[model samples]
Target: MSIAESVVRTIEDKGAGAFVESYDPAEENMVINLGPVHPSTHGVLRLVLELSGETVLDCRPVIGYLHTGIEKECEDQTWRGAVTAVTRMDYLAPFHNEQAFSLAVEKLLDLEVPPRGKYIRTLMSELGRLSSHLVWFGTSGLDMGAMSAMFYGFRERELFLDFYEMVTGLRMNHGYNIPGGVWQDLPEGWEEVCANIVSIMPGRIDDYESLLTENPIWLERTKGVGIMSIEDAVRFGATGPIGRAAGLDWDLRRDMPYEAYGELSFEVPVASEGDVYARYQVRMAEMRESIKLVGQVMEKMPEGDYKNMDPKIMPPPRSELNRSMEAVIHHFKLVTQGYTVPAGDAYAAVESPRGELGAYVVSDGGTAPYRCHVRDPSFINLQSLASMAKGGLVADLIAVIASVDPVMGGVDR
Candidate 1:
């Protein structure tokens, strides 16, 4: 008889009770809820984990605990006003959300924002990217027990936001980018504040590397934990740093250019490790590239009308209303009824800090959107958590979630 047959015969003779008794029930599996309320989650994300002792057998991420119906809310607002709602989707990469939505509206309207507007959008997107990474870095460090990283990361973010406030008049969710272009031109002294931030960030990044990249505890916790194979990452639809870490080697900024990304030269960093450490390294490198792009945008930024000068789409300047009766009527109509887009649908995507942030907008020749749907990267990237966490120690699961860097606002929205 074959060895398999002999073993089967023995098991048949011994019976089901004997087989059941062969292994400890405690070692079989234990189901536990990790959170809808945990810090490492970065927002209200609950993960159901099946544990075989401390080893994760399987994980199911439970999302929507923080849902605010942002997509649905977008349809209620005017085309230009939708930015206020969509900007809240990612929470961290608000500019990217606005950019994608604005680009989609522009596509539906068949309008191009002026060169200076395009460059400004690009600059803000990069700055938002840096801000997003800093948050990720801070939280990842906190999750891993490197307390200093949080402080350092937020320090950079505060200075970054100071520049944001200078231009848009709000640090977060500025509602700055609109359908035709931004809400206004870059304010006076924006260059000086931006220039100082760009100058000091390079040395700070070096300091961050020294603290965590080579630290024994950080290396031990993150180096090989939560390994996702390149094939699995692709199958799971993982993108951005998570995808790049698995050797995807594709950045929408480089592969699929948007905004002024085509004009700005930068490197797309990729790693084959597909581990928590690889994700960390990928984000760190991306921050450097964003800093470089910010510098380029500032240097080459053109001077022109920030918003498209089309009176049908953009309201005439407040100053123009004082002089011209036609301008008065234009501003009143735009503020009240809003501009109607041509009846059509369009999808525009930008490389958000997390991954591919896409907006699909439907216009029915109305002041408001017929339908607006956001393909948030947080939602897409969350699918990989189970794959990354399975077969890893339970403790490292925190590191895995942090490495993915999901913003619950985006996922649940």
Candidate 2:
């Protein structure tokens, strides 16, 4: 859409919500509300901006519009049920949510998932990483005036989502990852589908770089705009692409290997400039690395059972229930009350597409979790927005927000 057309559409969509309350137009400088539903802020985020003409003097991110109180809701559910709750926290990276929650519960139980399970988890997580970055790339491009990238991204994303649906029977919030392992084994021809995605993505990513990396307009909009210093990134607890863009060369997949990341060989991409362009480059490089991980995972996917053998944690098969009354009772209990986790607290962190998505869970030797809290990267990484937007033009704040890539579901959780 043309800039003028985009403006008219935005005004129409926002309608009465665009109006500022109890304000004066006579004031020298104006405080404007960007949106509780603005397109640029990304995902129902509101930015109250004190603007000097087109320059932004201050930016206060207004959040909680998407809040669902998921953390508190997690406490109300069983150990396994917490996975279902958290999977909705970051709807974009649902697998990461399930992975982190499962890992935490597993840690508390002192359970080690089988090698095949570990490899599958790693494989799915990397695919999620690629899926999320594609979204960021698309929306970031749209925010920065590159509309075509959005089309390319969603096109590729559908194929990736198809792979997810084949495994879990759902697309968005698949609670496929469980505490013991995955929900089930891979479906037939899963490897071929995975390999096809791996084959197509690399070349398409190259296409993205060719379109935007050196394009004068793209560089002009992104380079030196919304720069984050190494100090601020660390102080703000920013991880993943945002942290890597700021010269913080730390990836939990490499630095603190969980699942099968340690067994894989891949490079952690980094950039020193810490600007929108730097973040863009970091994410792009990471996509290539994810492709490498995908290849390794597809080829070396271990052979064995997916979930753990323990009947207490994983419910008995339906076939077994027909023959044995004990199996029938176990399945009923597992479905209704869920499994008991030992009395202890554990925290697990995974390198999500955005950043470090950590889950902290406390068990009271019961079916339900005593408490559960997610250290969502979106919630923390969002703090850097005001700092990044403070002296820049109002137009650039959108690019900054896109680079931070804060998923509002996670943020409001």
Candidate 3:
């Protein structure tokens, strides 16, 4: 019988006290609520699971519990202000959100970011990638009941967070990557700090690998659990580590280079396993790659303007404002009214840690976006949950959710 039919029959039998004398196999079929508030779900995601005994027969992910309507709110903010809204979506990898939005606005304005600005943006992007993967590693370990891995992952992640605060003045939701370029240049002593991070990060990754990569329990829980074939991944629009784990062999950094990514060289990690373990392996390799990218940025760091100096788009420096009445007036006008873009629309994407994070913006010759939308990977990737969760034991559902790593802020936004 269908699960629905089984449920009806079981309920009918229960009302008549049929179970007082005998039990029915159909009674074994059950449905359960997994989240919207539970730990191991990663965010405010609700999964309605249909089960037969301990095995999941079907799974449905219900989202929007954390929705704040940031996308719609973007329509009300000025071009320069929208970055603040988008940055909050992923929260874990806010730089990618800002990068995607900034790139789109720049495209709309036909603006160009200088070499130094591009490099700085690239530097932060990779650092953000490292921070994001570290959280994923820690949380994934937590989901798998490996307490030590969580401690290790977060310990290393704190270093990157320090770097973020030094650069952006805030660790998360930093409106650092503006439309013209970055809001400011790298502060003094940035080189020493960045060098210090890359120096220790590789060894730290090795530590993580040693802890969980070959642990028999880790392998048993993740090796063959939550497998999603490459064909299914593509159809469901999975990307980043999820698609890479399935052997999709595509990465926007390499395939569709942007910012300073084209100038830098790094391998896109891919595996054919398409299982929970493969997802873990790919992200671990990516953290190593991000470290390399950060090192490259430090060595090839260029000297130039960090933000486009367009008087209409960028406000005058505070130093200049005190010296020149013209600078003061210009700054006042720009801050109050903001710059306008020509009538057009554009879409720009960056390979976020989650996947292809894209921002689409439309201009109506106004200070604010006429329309704005983001193709958030977390939201798209959540589609694959049903496919991966079904036919797997209920205990393995946590691993599957962690492997996908959907951030609800991005998903619901």
Candidate 4:
């Protein structure tokens, strides 16, 4: 039977008595409501766990607390303005969100990003992945009672955020990515700056691993907990480290090359153990792979236009806007009215830090999208909660949830 079918069967068989009861049979079932406010839920996620003492009988993840009508909001904004809305969907990995939206827009325009632009994008996206994993490692450690790991992970994450701030002027919600290409070119000395980060991060990753990789406490908490096989993961649509940890060799960057990823060299780490430690190992190895890609980007850095030069699609150069009336008018019109796209539907998928984040956009040859929806991986992957947590102790529930690393913003958006 499929995972969904199995879940229904389990719920039907085991939950019939509980449903008939007027109130939760607290003493009999040992029912516990795990956090609509719990920090480990990632954000406003609640799990209604029907349990007998410490062992979970069934699990239902409760979401929708952070929904902001982002898809509906996109309908009101011009295509250019819609990036801001989608970027907020996966706040931790906003670059992937922007990349998916940009890819869809590029498909609509029949536009091709220049080699340099693609390379720069790959660099930034990998950096964003590293930043996101750092947050995951930090917060997961905090959830598991390793407080110092949180500090160490965030300390390393700040370096990447500093690089982002240097490039985009904002620490987060950087509207740096726009349709056709990025908003601006890489700043001067950007190569050196990126190289420096690449040089230092591997050792820092080792530091993080030193704290948790073989530590007896961490191993006891994570190893052999929340195990899920490759078949189970694929059936449930899990991706990124969650799927990879189960020996699924699926990564959109490699399987479906988007942007400049085809030219990059990096390993997709997989662990067959399919446990919480395996997930942790996959993410740690991915951090190293990201560092390798950053070095490659710096080595092959090309020189070219960052944004498209097409006047209709891209904004005119600032120099042209100062001296040319035509340039000023074009810029004004593009910003205020936005460019139109062909009437068609397109989908773009990127391997977000959490999982495979895909955007499906439909355009009716208008400035705004006819319909916009995101296939948030966290939302889909969270469905496997019962599969992983079914027979595990309540304590293991926190560890399993942390390993999956569901961002509620992505889930509820």
Instruction: Report the Cα RMSD per candidate.
Output: 7.2, 5.2, 4.3, 4.0
Name the lDDT value of residue 279 in candidate 3.
95
Against the true structure, what is each candidate's TM-score? Answer: 0.93, 0.93, 0.94, 0.93
Q: By summed lDDT, which 10 consecutive residues of candidate 2 come out lowest?
A: 1-10
After superposition, candidate 1 runs with Cα above 4 Å error: 1-27
Query: What residue runs in model 4 are displaced by over 4 Å at the alpha carbon?
Result: 1-27
lDDT of 1: 0.89
Task: Look at candidate 1 and tell me the lDDT of residue 235.
Answer: 96
> Number of backbone collisions per candidate, in order?
1, 0, 0, 0
After TM-score superposition, what is the CA distance of residue 106 in candidate 1 from its true location, in Å?
Answer: 0.6
- Could you say which candidate leads in TM-score? 3
Candidate 4 lands at a TM-score of: 0.93
Judged by whole-model lDDT over C-alpha atoms, candidate 3 comes out at 0.89
Among all windows of ten consecutive residues in candidate 1, which has the lowest summed lDDT?
A: 15-24
Error of 3 at 186 (Å): 0.7
**Per-residue lDDT of candidate 4, residues 93-121 (tens digit):** 88888888888888888998887778878
Compared with the true structure, what per-residue lDDT tens digits does model 1 show for residues 1-413? 42223433444476423222133375576556666677777888877666778898777776777899988888899988889999998999999999999999999999988989999999999999999999999989999999999999998899988888888989999899998889899988889889988999999999999999999999999999999999998899999999999999889999989778889899999999999999999999999999999999999999888889999999998889899999999999999999999999899999999999999999999999999999999999999998999899988999999999999999988
Candidate 3 Cα misplacement greater than 4 A, ranges: 1-27
